[model samples]
Target: MSHSRVNNQPAGQHGMVVAPGGGGNRNAQNMPVDADGRDWSNGLCGCCSSCGTCICATVLPCVVYGKNKHRYQHLDQQGTPEPSPGCCSGSCVAHGIFAACGLGFIFQMVNRGHVRHRYNIKGSGCGDCCTSFWCSPCQLVQESREIELEEQSFGTGRY
Candidate 1:
């Protein structure tokens, strides 16, 4: 069976007819029609905005680390390092250092979680199953550590 480009379509509905340069198909079900009545299949719509993409990228990390105490502490203490000339040097200076070093470490740890891929069972037997990889910041890191241990035991350098 051929996969359809349309995200969602009712049963027995004709799929969007895709052509070069995003031509073809004028049906509302296949393409989202805008207020101006322009056909989105003709490339009238603008690409996703930078802010939208950033939100998409940041959301996973936020969801994963938002509840963690360490992540909260790191964010709460950001950019306070190295006291100003007139500022007091006690807690302020300490906080500044913590923000600088702590934020970097925390970001690194969170980013690592954001990039690691996960797999899911696709079919009945191992031979029939296909692996799908997804990057999810919410994934437990201990699972990754366990996978690493298994790989080491099998003498696999990386997988």
Candidate 2:
């Protein structure tokens, strides 16, 4: 049998090598990474950070979930200082329905996303889902702490 060269390309030209953090597709200069992005002020498992929040989340998650939505909406409205929503707000009822079906994680995940977006917190949708699904009460309290901190900083004065 006769030997013949089947491939002509050189081995050295297989691919391009780029340095880490070299403004590649992920961190392109024009993309402008948000320096303002921040970690959650309260850790997911740091329920002890606020005893009241922890208790409320564990005892009445629906209430916490509803209030989180309520407070986030008020914050979105930019200092309107809406009256405090009752514990049985629409969000609470929705949360109760979802929780009854053992699917409250879905609602909590979305709520967590809203919290993340509103505060420019450093987290992804998947992460929020996992955190919310795995430990809902902890996630609720964590979100509660973050929002409460923001409210305080903005002088909302409604804990």
Candidate 3:
């Protein structure tokens, strides 16, 4: 690997040593090294998860992985047919969001319980732009407010 600064400076100019490797001896000038002896690539550095693909590596951390993992788990529970014990947690909401986002159905069965009803009510207005189903109640309130505003405007002959 060829080491260079984020600004594209050669590693040697920044006191970086050439590791004993056949690949290009590249080291980022300002990045921290990790416990595994791998340089902590900057946020812009492209690295793949264990799945061997980096397509969504950066965006997935915040929106698809970590805390979002719970979302996936949630959808899987709600969407599955056979009720798995693991699905009872909040993971179903996350899973449903992930599934709705085109991640595919991880859940074994689809359970259209009150949870799904709430999701349907919320998703109807914005086509499911909201990521978490838990926000359905809030969405309903917002929808009502919007309706009230529309009615008031119409009544005032403002179209």
Candidate 4:
């Protein structure tokens, strides 16, 4: 049995591998709070904190959901790709469709989980589902604010 090696190293494409403590790992950065995790930057009921977002969410929830999801996905990334396919295409459309069928909460709930995970915000999947289901408008606004705050911290200069 013979094994091929490169300079006595394993032979394979390792370009995507990020060496530990070698830098370039964004997720390795410090989380905001202690090991118990941190509370959401904005309270669940703090809808009035951003009136325009609340109004937009109330009037056009699909658009708001799409926009929030888009922003959240790109929160820590660099560069301006596009807004989000869902914003102008599938995302908003599916949200509208699900809303009409009374299942819009499911879509937003998944995104809510992503936001919580990204920020290390303390909350359960059940809680996120309930929040998305019960107070959708407020959830949308809250997520919008959270993503906005993160973007501000990153200094991307686009809101």
Candidate 5:
């Protein structure tokens, strides 16, 4: 019972210890969006709107998706770094570029979710999964257009 009181502070070597189990940035700001809050085009509406992308999506979906996906990852990379590795995994340009290996939709689907969050698009995880699963190309086109529109309005000049 003769112990001396110690300072109530973390060890100096610990630096800044980020809390585990979701205490950091819950809202991802990697990709900025405009305050306009415009509604997005339907996933199936790419044909009449963006015939070029629609045709490319139909003819060479792999090429179109590969380029776009890689570009998406790069956009995120140029922004604020994620708090943790698991915060975002599909931000690899190389991997996204090779997203034509049939299993790439999994990664693109995840990326789509991030885009939705960035643009404040109202939707459920199940909805994103279904859109990505059914018409991945259309999803890509919609995402690309959304990004372009946001960049144009916000004038981020990053993309």
Candidate 6:
């Protein structure tokens, strides 16, 4: 009687291609892929690890948020310093005006959505709404770190 062994090798480890007719890994298929294939950074607490950023976030949260917004939107130039992250970016005048009117939070929300889209991060850890409402500073910190991470990882220089 002829005997045959089952192909029990681990997927993607047996020199198997990832295309059709090759070993398929559901886990690998589900991994998020940015333009440069770098994973997104950690959460808001990551800012604390950086002394300067933590201080900035605690002191002038609005300004930090503005920069984070500009970075996330991928605007060019050393854009004007904004008091807030505007609906769009790179315009400090509009940012100042919008912030004074208490509309900066809304602008921040929009940018937060953009960050999520770019990094493919799913909303979790008490949901986006609760996080933004209860701990806006944390959200700002997280976004800032993500922008920094995106730039450092992908060399986008957006931040």
lDDT of 4 by residue, 75-155 (tens): 434322223335444788899999999999999999998877766677889998999999999999988877676555444
RMSD of each: 22.0, 15.3, 22.4, 7.7, 11.2, 12.2
TM-score of 3: 0.18
Worst 10 residues of 2 by lDDT: 21-30
Q: Once superposed on the true structure, which residue ranges of model 2 sit more than 4 Å away at CA?
A: 1-36
By TM-score, the better pick of 1 and 6 is 6
lDDT of 1: 0.28
**Residue by residue across 27-57, what tens digits does model 1's lDDT show?**
4223442332222221212212333423333
TM-score of 6: 0.53
Better of 4 and 6 by lDDT: 4
- Write model 2 residue lDDT over 1-159, tens digit each, in one string: 334453553342112222221211211112222554566666777998788878988888899999888877775664443366667789999998988898888989998997776555677999999998899999999887776765555454565
| Model 4 weakest lDDT span, ten residues long | 14-23
| Candidate 3 Cα deviation (angstroms), residue 59 | 35
RMSD (CA, Å), candidate 5 to true, equals 11.2
Q: lDDT by residue for model 6 over 65-148, one digit each (tens)?
A: 767766544422332222234543354345456767766566566667666655556654345555555566677787776656
Candidate 5, overall lDDT?
A: 0.54
| Per-model TM-score on C-alpha atoms | 0.17, 0.72, 0.18, 0.72, 0.53, 0.53
* Candidate 4 residue 144 C-alpha distance from true site, Å: 0.8
Instruction: Give lDDT tens digits, candidate 3, residues 17-85.
Output: 332221121231234433323222222122222222233322232222322233323333443221222
Candidate 5 colliding pairs, count? 0
Off by over 4 Å in 5: 1-38, 41-43, 79-102, 154-159
